[model samples]
Target: MNKIQQQKSENISFNYFSLLSLMFVKKYNIQINQKNEKNILSFYS
Candidate 1:
């Protein structure tokens, strides 16, 4: 019973970590895309 409870907690924490990492990755991707767009615009200008 105790082990099951511990496993549940671990699973919850793992899920939270994955969610945080996913958000971070999405933000990083957006920033990279914006930078690329800016570079392209500057090159054309």
Candidate 2:
């Protein structure tokens, strides 16, 4: 029983970390895209 509970908690923590990392990656991608757009605009100007 204790082992089962431990496994469940570990799974939950792993899922939480996965979600956090996904969000971080998405935010990073958005920032990079915005930076690229600014560079392009500056080049045109």
Candidate 3:
């Protein structure tokens, strides 16, 4: 329950969520070589 432990937990959560998001994008047949410029732009838009 210390500050350092809390920071580490937050970092691990972020890494896990990021990995899950990437897997989701691929699972739905999303292309990764579209320069990611318009891809992300349209994705979040």
Candidate 4:
């Protein structure tokens, strides 16, 4: 009973952590893409 509750809480926390990391990764990717675009434009110029 108590163990089950603890397990549930752990699962919830793990899920939340993954969601936060996913958002962080998406933001990082967008930044990288913007940098790449700037590099490409500079190269053409």
Candidate 5:
């Protein structure tokens, strides 16, 4: 393959990876929030 085409594919893959990471972070944040709430309640009790 030509260099330009190879570079284009690499860029596309990088973008896809970034999108996946963003989604994962969002899901992680939700779980963290719920866990934090439970922990706070237990500590207070």
Candidate 6:
């Protein structure tokens, strides 16, 4: 209700969003790397 509380809430939400974004990015990176590997293998074959 107060300014301090509102700021705290905003900080928590921001942290949650950042953590989710980081996890999503990590998963995406893994998928991209796997796809690259597959492509390289196919190209060689």
* Candidate models: Cα lDDT each: 0.92, 0.92, 0.81, 0.92, 0.90, 0.91
Candidates in order, TM-scores: namely 0.71, 0.69, 0.55, 0.69, 0.62, 0.67
| Alpha carbon lDDT at 18, candidate 3 | 97
Q: What C-alpha lDDT, on a 0 to 100 scale, does residue 6 get in candidate 6?
A: 95
- In terms of lDDT, which candidate is stronger, 3 or 5? 5
Predicted structure 1, TM vs. truth: 0.71
Q: Model 6: how far is 11 from its true place, Å?
A: 0.5
lDDT for 25 (candidate 3): 80
| Per-residue lDDT over 1-45 for candidate 3, one digit per residue giving the tens place of the 0 to 100 score | 699999999999999999999899886645564556687888788
Which digits, one per residue and each the tens of the lDDT, describe model 4 over residues 1-45? 999999999999999999999999999977887879988678779
Worst 10-residue lDDT window for candidate 6 reads: 35-44
Give residue 15's lDDT in candidate 2 (0 to 100): 100
**Per-residue CA lDDT of candidate 5, range 1-45, in tens?**
699999999999999999999999989977887879987678779
Q: Give the winner by TM-score.
A: 1
- Residue 18, model 1: lDDT of 100
Q: Write the per-residue lDDT of candidate 1 for residues 1-45, one digit (tens) a residue.
A: 999999999999999999999999999977887879987678779
TM-score of 4: 0.69
Residue 9 of model 5: what lDDT?
97
- Candidate 5 — which pairs collide? none
Candidate 4: C-alpha RMSD after superposition: 5.3
Residue-wise lDDT of candidate 2 within 1-45, one digit each (tens)?
Answer: 999999999999999999999999999977887879987678779
Task: In angstroms, give how far residue 1 of model 2 lies from its true place.
Answer: 1.5
Q: Which regions of candidate 1 fall more than 4 Å away from where they truly are? A: 37-45
Ranking by TM-score: 1, 4, 2, 6, 5, 3
- Steric clash pairs (candidate 2): none
